[model samples]
Target: MSFLPYALAAWLFFVGLYGIVTSRHFVHLVICLGVTQSSTYVLLLAIGYRTGKKAPIFTSGVPVKVGAVDPVVQALTLTDIVVGVTVAALLLALVIEIWKRAGTVDPDELRRNRT
Candidate 1:
């Protein structure tokens, strides 16, 4: 119902994009990418949120007629987080390898040194 969460997600996404655009080091770039990816979690939570609804889990006392939040959204958010962490780890490993070989993590320096 409210637009605040959507606005926050958009703000986070843009901030991350700006950081990525201005980043000089590979590690910093990877961190920015992670930040950008986090916005999706906020967006997903917002979409699944219900003003007065209960969680998707149902118990004996809880009536089936009562509204429940979307479980699929929660699942997707969890999956997204897992994928993001995996991607971040892989990117960080690649950055470490680059640093080991190139002696520098700066993108501009890498470009200059590239054959």
Candidate 2:
């Protein structure tokens, strides 16, 4: 049970890498990049997780020194999600432009036309 998250993260990373490697279209490559970024979020959350800790919050009835899950990892993951979305959007836009100019989204065709 404890190892599930790690395994999932690794799987996501590998799948994304495989997709990227075998991708033929620029749009498919952009989507694969997103899959790769999702693995980091899972890994970060897994690393910061506490087995039986409370949320990192102050409450009147709770003990002042009770163990709380670290909030930094959650914060970082949120930031990463925002940045990743922005980057994915930019990449998609670039791919659209490439398709417009090249008349095709195939990577091999684009490379051939670049010469």
Candidate 3:
């Protein structure tokens, strides 16, 4: 259980990379990009995870302890999620435009259609 997230993250990253490398369509490529990016979130959270630790919120009586999980990584992971979603959305929009103009999303077809 302890090593699960780390292993999953690595597996997800490789799987996404494989998808991107073998992608035929622009949308597929974008989706693979998202999968790859998600692996990083898993990794960041896993790295920041501390067993049996409470959240870092300040309380009147709870003493601050060294065992508290680092909050910075959690924050960074959240920001990464927002940024990644925005970028993926923008990319999908571009793909939609390309499909509208090209009548296809296949990368090879688009390349051949290039004037």
Candidate 4:
């Protein structure tokens, strides 16, 4: 069950990457990034859901013997979210800049400007 989510997320991310790479529209690329991010978040939450573990809050009256989910992964997910947002923001800013400078959002056009 745990591995299923991870596999699905991996597959979804692959599809998103394919779309992003083949996409002719900048909007489609951004949407694919969001899709990839959501799959990763789903995978993270699924991994965190163990069989019968208590909350990870470390309360005073908890008596469960199950191992808590790795807080490192949780923190990583949060950091990933922040980084994803930052990247999307930057991409949007770049798109806006491109539109202002070239009046087009085609990746091919942007690449042509490189040389």
Clashes of each: 0, 0, 0, 0
Candidate 2: residue 9 Cα off by (Å): 1.0
Q: Candidate 2, which segments miss by more than 4 Å at Cα?
A: 59-66
TM-scores of the models, in the given order?
Answer: 0.91, 0.87, 0.87, 0.77
- Residue range 1-115, candidate 2, lDDT tens digits: 3999999999999999999999998888999999999999999999889988877787799676668887899999999999999999999999989878889998888788889
Better of 1 and 2 by TM-score: 1
Q: Who is ahead in TM-score, 1 or 3? A: 1
- Model 1 residue runs over 4 Å out of place are 60-62
Q: Per-residue alpha-carbon lDDT of model 3 for 1-115, expressed as tens digits?
A: 3999999999999999999999999988999999999899999988988888877677799778766777888999989999999999999999999988989999988888986
Could you tell me the TM-score of candidate 4? 0.77
Q: Per-residue lDDT tens digits of candidate 1, residues 6-97?
A: 99999999999999999999999999999899899999999999988888987798568878989899999999999999999999999999
lDDT of 4 by residue, 3-114 (tens): 8888888888899999898987787798899888878887887777776665566767976577676666687789889999999999888878878988789888878887
lDDT of 4 at 114: 75
Q: Top model by TM-score, which number?
A: 1
Residue 34 in model 4: lDDT: 83
Number of clashes in model 1? 0
Lowest summed lDDT window (length 10), candidate 1: 58-67
